[model samples]
Target: MKNFRMRVWWFLCVLPLLSACGGTEVTLGEDEDVAGMKGVVERIPAPYGAGCGIEIPVEASYLPDPGVCGNGICEDGEDMYSCMDCAVCGDGCCAGGERSWNCALDCGSVCGDHFCNGGETAATCRADCAPKLGSVLLQRVRSCRNRFPLPCNSTQTRSEFHWWDDFNVAQDKQKRTYLAQPFNPGRDGVRHLVFIIAGQQDGDMASGLTGQRDGFKDAFRDNDGSMWVGVDGQSLAYRLMAEVYRSPDDTFMGLAFDARFNYGFTPSNKQEIENAYYEWLKEKFYASNLRSIYLAGHSRGGCLAARLGRRFKQDFPQVPLILHIFDGVCHVNDHEFGTNGSGYLNPLMNMNGDWRAYSTNVGAQFPTTQNLAVYNMLSGDQVLGDFADYFVSVHAFSHASPSAVTPSFTEGDWYRQEWFTWTHNGMAHNTVSDALWHYQLSCNRFGC
Candidate 1:
């Protein structure tokens, strides 16, 4: 990354007239001929038969005029000037003599447009050079993938959609800020967030929130600094229905149907989502200014957050994604919870239990892992549990009389309350926007 130093000098040619006094004609000197050269030298021709010094070769691109040189002699078809006696005129080539100059309308022959000097050649210089600008040609190439229109990489599926250029939010939105408000817009240390929505929609879900446009737009308006992406896990599964059976609505509870299908969401899908997410994430936020990312979610959403954290250090291996889980679960354990505080959630495992019972039962599967935070509020308490487990934090609150009061509610409880109660059956769970608000509040309150 060494910078080049440049200094261009223009020299005017001069010729002396010979008089009846019979003074000796002078030849050009190397010192006078070479106006702006570095690292070499030669002798010059003097009057009264003095030998002219060695001449230096100049670039032909800036050729001097042949009209009047300092040699003081008009020989052949050329005009000349005195080289030995005239100190006022530089000693360059005289008429009919060998000479050189570094001047040209096109220097492409000598050096390419963006030559070592860093300036464009005449033929390439434009009023604005932003488009032609390229990053410091990275030494290594990075891999990227896309997540939507499921059967993502299946050989059986043939998709008509073709999206290239490697999805990069940061690079594409150059100078443009995203997710602006709650988090100050244009802040360099912004983190990236990816949301993987998992659920079987028997109701009007996709219509209520256009997963791609409205969700992303609202997320951006709320906190436009971080990069955001969403993946429809159910859609992906439905697309791969040949591998698994689609559950019948009449066979299970609303939450049970989701848990039965999405709870078992495979690691393969998780890997694919993370792969595509960061491939584009890094390209967009690779600047030195980028901050660490925060992975988060709700029910199925929270599970995705955990899966990403667990394999992040393996799949993307190099990227550092901060793990944040909100009311999420991983897998079902048979450690009798009420029997020994392990599989106590077995009571609510009924396919026909209330939605709350299903949520609590699901929480058991999502125990606090070393890399993930399983945040959950106790059945009826307003205070969250051991959610502050270094990396994981949880909050519990009851919908009963006093606990439902906002004043008696904890901030974490307020989060879930506001989120689950946002729209239809908590279908409008905008983790990106929620995370942004929490991040802004946290930064403001604790200087995080």
Candidate 2:
């Protein structure tokens, strides 16, 4: 019995050890199954910890499911968690149940789209809308017009007007510049031509021809042949004369001379220069058909025009002529406050045609004379005012006699002295442009 007791005690002690060893063997198989089922279980942690620890083998199949879309969430099936339905996956339609704010990838905010969305403005997206008037005009001046056409007979025809071609460009005297335009040979009636002299600047003709005044030039070229006035923006005028006058063979002429050569004092050679210009005009157009001539000049060119006008009146006494001068007057002295000379005064008196002069109110510098229609535009700025005051004081001593003074002269019919808030440059450069715009608008309604 004692021995039986001893054996039972021994068995009792070893029983826990045997049971632990058996548990170890079973755990090994379970761990192996857990590791092998990791991928199938979607790497989800077991509900009881360490993934099905000591649980039944069937429980391994019931491990928590992982997020199919990799969003770190547990869901029912692959379909619900699939990225195919997500709005961020670059689908054209933002219809994945997502708003633009939430999913910008699908609904981009860009310009040039048909819709004016994404903070797009008319300026930014002009392709989708129209701009304002000021912007439109600004843009028009910025772009250059190439091969501008003459509007005629309901048809468009392109032509080039070389405003500087008539000047002595080449040293070779044989190379003479000629004026020609498409004319209706059968048309009949007298036509008018206008000449516009540019200011004292090199390449002013080229600038006038190809720059800001291109549209203005086009207006002249496109006008109907009946009483059409050809405006030459620079010296050396040429145009295709239309025979729309009473005499079918008669041709009217307008010439704008580049007074580049008459820069400084040319008292002795002034007459010779004037004669050359007259000869050019006579050679180009029949002097008999020239019923009227309109001569215009800007700056020093105006002084030259005034001198030339005196000569023109003497040469073509029958041809009624008009002088349009801008900020130009001859002075005995080249100094700013010099006394006015006969070169400028004689033309004012002798020119049998209308006289219109546009200038800034620089006191004595601006010629104020009888028979001279002067538009003395005041800038109204303190700087110009002070300058004018100084100019008047310098020449105040020279005007002791009423005849020698500008204010004493008889005011022409169109004499106007007005004040404007514009700049000096604006008043000087844009006067002709403004006048041309008004004249063209009127010409469209009434024959020029």
Tens digit of lDDT per residue, candidate 2, span 1-448? 6544433432333223333211112122343333133222122111222221244342332211122333333235532112222323344443222233333354444444445555554546543332211100100001122333632222111112211223322221111111222221221333443444544443323222112232323332222211222343321221111111111233233323234434453454444445445554444445555555455555545555555555555666655545554444444354322333221121223432112222222233333332223333223222224566355211111221223223223233423333333332343454554334323333333333
Best by lDDT: 2
Regions more than 4 Å wrong, model 2:
1-191, 203-258, 329-331, 334-428, 433-448
- Evaluate all candidate structures by whole-model CA lDDT and list the values in order: 0.28, 0.33
Q: Give per-residue lDDT, candidate 2, residue 48.
A: 22
| Tens digit of per-residue lDDT, candidate 1, span 1-448 | 1111111221222221122112233334464443344422222212211122433233111222333332354445332223222232223222122221121221111233222223543334322211121111100011112234432221101111111112221222121211111122223434333223333222213311113222332322211223334423322212111112111211110011111113333544334434443443333343344333344444444454454454443444333343433334333321111111221111122321121211223223223322222223222111123343223222221222222333223323212222132211233243334434444443333222
Report the alpha-carbon TM-score of model 2 versus the true structure.
Answer: 0.34
Q: How accurate is candidate 2 locally (lDDT)?
A: 0.33
Q: Single out the weakest 10-residue window by summed lDDT for candidate 1.
A: 249-258
Cα error of candidate 1 at position 147, Å: 21
